[model samples]
Target chain A: MPVIKARVTVTLKNGVLDPQGKAIEHALDGLGFGGIGSVRQGKVFDVEIEGADKAKAEADLNAMCEKLLANTVIENYSVTLI
Target chain B: MKSAVVLLPGLNRDRDMIAALTKISGKAPVTVWQTDTEIPDVDLIAIPGGFSFGDYLRCGAIAARMPVMRAVAEKAAKGVQVVGVCNGFQILVEAGLLPGALMRNTSLKFVCREVKLEIANANTAFTRNYAAGQVIRCPVAHHDGNYFTDPETLARIEGEGQVVFRYAEGTNPNGSINDIAGIINEKGNVLGLMPHPENLIETAHGGNDGRALFESALGLPKAA
Candidate 1:
């Protein structure tokens, strides 16, 4: 069985307020970074699983995201195999 | 009435909740640990506030998936009364026992202060002692106390009288939608609120405004 690597990204859903992102946007403006349309903060997780089955690994990663990696209520998640 | 308090690591308010319950009910509440798969029979289950699992992934997100939470969910399903305060409220939402989600305060700062709370609906088991539209003082302390939900869900909850408490008198500390400070489940047995009612249940605490909530849930006569 080969080791499968994956990455999961989680971001706040649209229309949900992002206070941390807004703070960063303000800080960037203070630093003279101009013309920034907007800013949104998110989280990324790099995971490694020991398995030769790609489909099973993908399924497991999605399950992990649904159960723990991301809160589906206010956040969206994506999984990419590497 | 017999009561129990859920215990999880990084939670700092178990002692306060236990003391409040003990003082109010004249009996010490049993403490349930995070890994426990079964909870003893009790009338009320209270989950106190704190930075559970260090607020990893999200506030209350990690703790919500613990074994004890499954037991709590089971108890809630059976029509037993459940109350969650602060981070406890966050856990309930994360565990899918309650609607909506608590997010980072819109001010991006942790708020630890007193706020006025209005009894939006006094008909539930938790707020029966207070009159609808009555305002009381309670302390709220948290970084992610901002409550939010989709428009449809919000409308439904509002229409159903599930919105039990609201921040009143321009004291919405976390930018919660509709100034919501507390809410109950559709069945009205489960309640999750951001304020610390336990902290204000006695005259020594400066007021006993929060005592009636416990009295209501515990089926005790209204406090004199």
Candidate 2:
């Protein structure tokens, strides 16, 4: 069996307001950084799992994202296997 | 009426709820822990305010996934009266027991103050004691109580008269859309609100305006 590493990224939906992200963007400008248009903060989860194939691991990771890792109402999540 | 308040770790308002229920309903609500898969017999179930799971992920995201919430969902489906206050409301929404999502306040600040709310629909189990469109005061304390939903869903809830409470005009503390403060489910059995009615059950706390909410839910006579 091959061990798979999964990375999940959870981010607020585009239309949803992200105050923390906006605050961070403003703070970067105050610190003299230039040319950064916007910053959106999000969550990342890394997990290691035992799986025989990539397809099965993707399916399992997708289930985790739907059930617990992210709230679909206000957020979008992406999964990547490494 | 028998009531139970779900207890989640990091939740701090269960005591206040217990006291209010005892004073208003004549018995302290049984405390059901997060890990419990079943709640004892009760007529009402309350999810009180607090930073459950330290409000990690999202306000109610983690706690909603707890084992007890499955039971809460089941009980709610059976038409048991359920109310979630503050973070409890967040948990209910996150658990899919209610509609819409609570977002960060439009001001991006944690607001803690007494806000005036108008009883939007006073015929529900939770607000029958209030006259339709009557105004009452309750304390609201939260950073993520701004409610959001699609226009279609919003219109549906509004048309169905499911919106239970709205922040009185000129006193919209959190910039909630349509000045929403609380709402009930389509069946009129589940309520989720940002304000803390439990904090105003006694006159010493300022006023007894919140007392009627409990009385209404318990089907008790109005307090004098």
Candidate 3:
């Protein structure tokens, strides 16, 4: 079996307030940066599994996102094979 | 009535919760550790505050998946009264035992201070000792306590009187939607709140305003 590498990105859903992102946005503005409309923060997780089947790896990655990587109630998640 | 307190690693307030329960109910609550798969019979289960699992992966997210939480969920399903305070509340929501999510404070800072709480609904098992609209003093100490939910959920909870406690007056510390300080589940057996009622339950704590909550939940006679 070969190792399958994947990346999972988790972010707050639209309409949910992101105070940390907002703070960073303001800091950037204070530092003379321009044209920044808004900012949102998110997390990324790199995972590796011992599997050769891409289909099975994708399914397992999705399950991980649903169960732990992202809280579906307030955040959205996407997975990509690398 | 008998009570039990759930214990999880990094939860600093479990001792406070146990002391409060013991003082109020005249019996020390049985402690259920994070790895425990089963909890003894008890009328009430209290999950205290603190940064469980160091608030990693979102507050209470990791702790919610612990074996003890599975037991807690089972007990809650059986209609046992469950109250999660602060981090405990976060755990409950993360476990899907409650609704909505507690986000970072809009101020982007940790807030620790006394806030006034209005008993929005006094008919539930946890707030029955207080009258509707009665304001009481309680302390709040948390960073990610800004509660947000979908509009439909907000409307439904409000309509069903599930919003049991609201931050009263101008003391909304964390920018919670609807000034919500506490809420109960649809079945009315589970409650999750941000304030630390256990901290203000006795005179030594400067006031006894939070005692009624325990009294009500324990089915004990109200203090005169």
Candidate 4:
């Protein structure tokens, strides 16, 4: 049986302010990289599941994202299998 | 008054809370570990400050899911008075015992200083000793103390007098909307705030303004 892998990316909602992203953007500009546009910071979690059932793995990953990987109030998450 | 302080891994302010309660109530408070699923009947339950679970996966997220919080949540539902300060506020929000969420400070800085707070409502069990609209000074120390909630909820809370404290004029230290520093649940039995009132309960710490909060919860007269 082949194992399954899921990648979960958590990012702040579109309207939520991102101070860390702003600081990074400013720092890049200070370093002469003026072309860098607005930046949004996020977290990525790579998880591996034991079974080959892709559907079950997706469901489990979604549950994890909803319960712990992301706070839905301030964040949005996407799940990808690779 | 019989009080209990919930303890969690990485919690650093339990002692301060214990000391404050002992000083005010003339006896030590009971300590309940985070792993415990049931709480003894008590007049008040305090969730003190400190970076629980190392502030990982969002501040207080992990601790909010602990077994003890379920009991706390149940107690709150049953009209038990619950007060959470600093990181405890975060845990309360994450546990859904309170509304809104704390975000990173707008300046991306950890603010550690005394701030002036205007008592927004003094009718609740937690603030009965304070005069309505009174200004009190307390210390706030946190990196992610900015409180945020949707506009609808904001209007509702304000309309219902759920906002308990507001940063004094020109004293908004963390960019919270409407300069809100603390709020109570819909029923007013639960209170959560970013300021550490426990740190201000003694004259040696600059003022005893915060003492009224604990005293009021215990049904005692205001400190002289």
Candidate 5:
């Protein structure tokens, strides 16, 4: 079995309201970081799998994200395989 | 012994929870839908786990603002017991019944499994059946089970003993700090936990650890 490394990152799409990110940005502003423009919060998933094919792993990862990891509507995701 | 279980639109577990509670309480709890304008008399109020509002817009964020939830909040202000599980947990956090928000699991998976929970506080209505520092196994199925809170809030929760069920050591799975699996309000009336106790209430379920949770309210023995 070949071990495939995959990372899935979930981010709030532009025009979506990220309360957590906004809160962080506000805190930074309060800390005198006046130049802070914007921040979008997201989820990062790091998974290592044992498999023979990287392509199969990528497809499976996508399925997982669609069914569970990413909310699809509010969040956009990009998957990377190593 | 009379309890009411609120049913949010898209709430799929309300019936399952009702069965579990009825089996334990000897009476079916009343179900209050999200659009309802009234909350009847009941000793305990439960927000069952489900894809409320199709899990749209940050899990329970939308459902937290439902009309029935407003009523539930009013009841809670009078110290009525409120319990939320999974999506229900998200609702509690969104409703501010409990502190902190559930984020994506560090593993980024919709993990569904049986995991051990360390009962940190045995003094509350929900966990009184278990001994403090005791460990028990239960099931969890969720993607946003990762719990996060500010340092100050974390310290406060620890000092106040509001941290109830913590994940067994080194088994966080979700990257929750302090391995928190559940928490209660400062008053100990509202509880939010990620694990599905309703899934483990029967002897036929291969485990009966969850029976203790519902039984705790009635001061009954562990079903296992």
Candidate 6:
């Protein structure tokens, strides 16, 4: 099995509560920043794995997402394997 | 020393945490409901991991406003050892017990697994048993553990060595800048982490790393 890695990022899509991001926006406004369109908050995951086959690797990666990585509610997951 | 676990409606790990706590405390921790204003006299107050109030209104936002939290906050001001795990962590950040807030993962998902953490600063009361830079395993299960803080605040946390634990290597599990896993208050008494060490209490459960947390509490009571 070759050593593989997964780089994943999770973010609230647009128009979410994003209070943290919103707070930053308001803070920026308070700091006299102008024409600031918006702010969004998200997290990133860098994972390490060992696998022989690419197909199995993909399946395991998907399983990792479905079972643990992503909640599939109120958020979205994007995976990038390197 | 007496200790209590704050039990919010959606908190699912109260029993597990209490079970782990008993090993060091020599007695089970009291569970206090969210609606209650009074927190029993204890050396520490634990905000256990779980989907408090279904994680609505943001991860810990609603819990921070809970009545029990108000009491918790007051005691924390007096230097009480208030530890928050997962949802408890979110609540602490939401309540401003610790700096920074946990935002959605860049992938926007809930993560649950045994994670590797490097003990970043072990001088604090909660991490004194662990060696600095040593790595330990614990479970992290959360949707909003991406820790975010402004640059100046980040600098202060770093300068003051308030960060207690961080992800090992480049395993920036949640896109958390600095791979932060846990942080302590300015006084180093309170700790909040996205991982659930309480769930890793026994070897049968995978490991006994969680015991150290309670062990650190042995010499201290919940409050003055």
For model 5, fnat equals 0.00
For residues B1-224, write the lDDT of model 4, one tens digit per residue: 79999999998999999999999999799999999999999999999999999999899999999999999999999999999999999999999888888999998999999899999999899999999999999999999899998888889999999999999968888889899999999999999999999988987987898999999999999878
Task: Give the per-residue Cα lDDT of candidate 6 at B31.
Answer: 84
lDDT of 6 at A11: 81
| C-alpha positional error of residue B102 in candidate 3 after TM-score superposition, expressed in Å | 0.4
Model 3: CAPRI class: high
Q: Could you give the C-alpha RMSD of every candidate to the true structure, in order shown?
A: 0.7, 1.5, 0.7, 1.1, 14.9, 17.2
What's the i-RMS for candidate 1 in angstroms? 0.8
lDDT (C-alpha, whole model) for all candidates: 0.96, 0.91, 0.95, 0.93, 0.84, 0.79
User: What TM value does chain A in model 1 reach?
Assistant: 0.96
lDDT of 6: 0.79
TM-score between candidate 6 chain A and the true chain A: 0.75
What is the C-alpha lDDT profile of model 4 across A1-82, one tens digit per residue? Answer: 6889889999999878888999989998999997887999999999989998899999999999888889888899999999
User: How well is each residue in B83-198 modelled by candidate 3, as lDDT tens digits?
Assistant: 99999999999999999999999998899999999999999999999999999999999999999999999999999999999999889999999999899999999999999999
Clashing pairs in 4: none
TM-score of 2: 0.95
Clashing pairs in 3: none
Q: Please list the residue runs of candidate 5 whose C-alpha ends up more than 4 Å from where it truly belongs after superposition.
A: A1-82, B219-224
- The alpha-carbon deviation from the true structure for residue A77 of candidate 3, after best TM-score superposition, in angstroms, is 0.5
Model 4 CAPRI quality = medium
Which has the higher DockQ value, candidate number 1 or candidate number 2? 1
lDDT of 2 by residue, B81-109 (tens): 99999999999999988899898887789
Flag clash pairs in model 5: none
Q: Which order, best to worst by DockQ?
A: 1, 3, 4, 2, 5, 6
Tens digits of per-residue lDDT, candidate 6, B1-224, equal 77899998888888888888886678888888888898878888899988887877468777887788889988898888989998899889877789987877755567777788888997887877777888988888888888877667889998999989898866556777678888998988789998888877676887777667767765633221
Q: DockQ (Cα-based) per candidate?
A: 0.85, 0.57, 0.82, 0.77, 0.03, 0.02
Highest lDDT, which number?
Answer: 1
User: Model 5's A-chain: what TM-score?
Assistant: 0.90
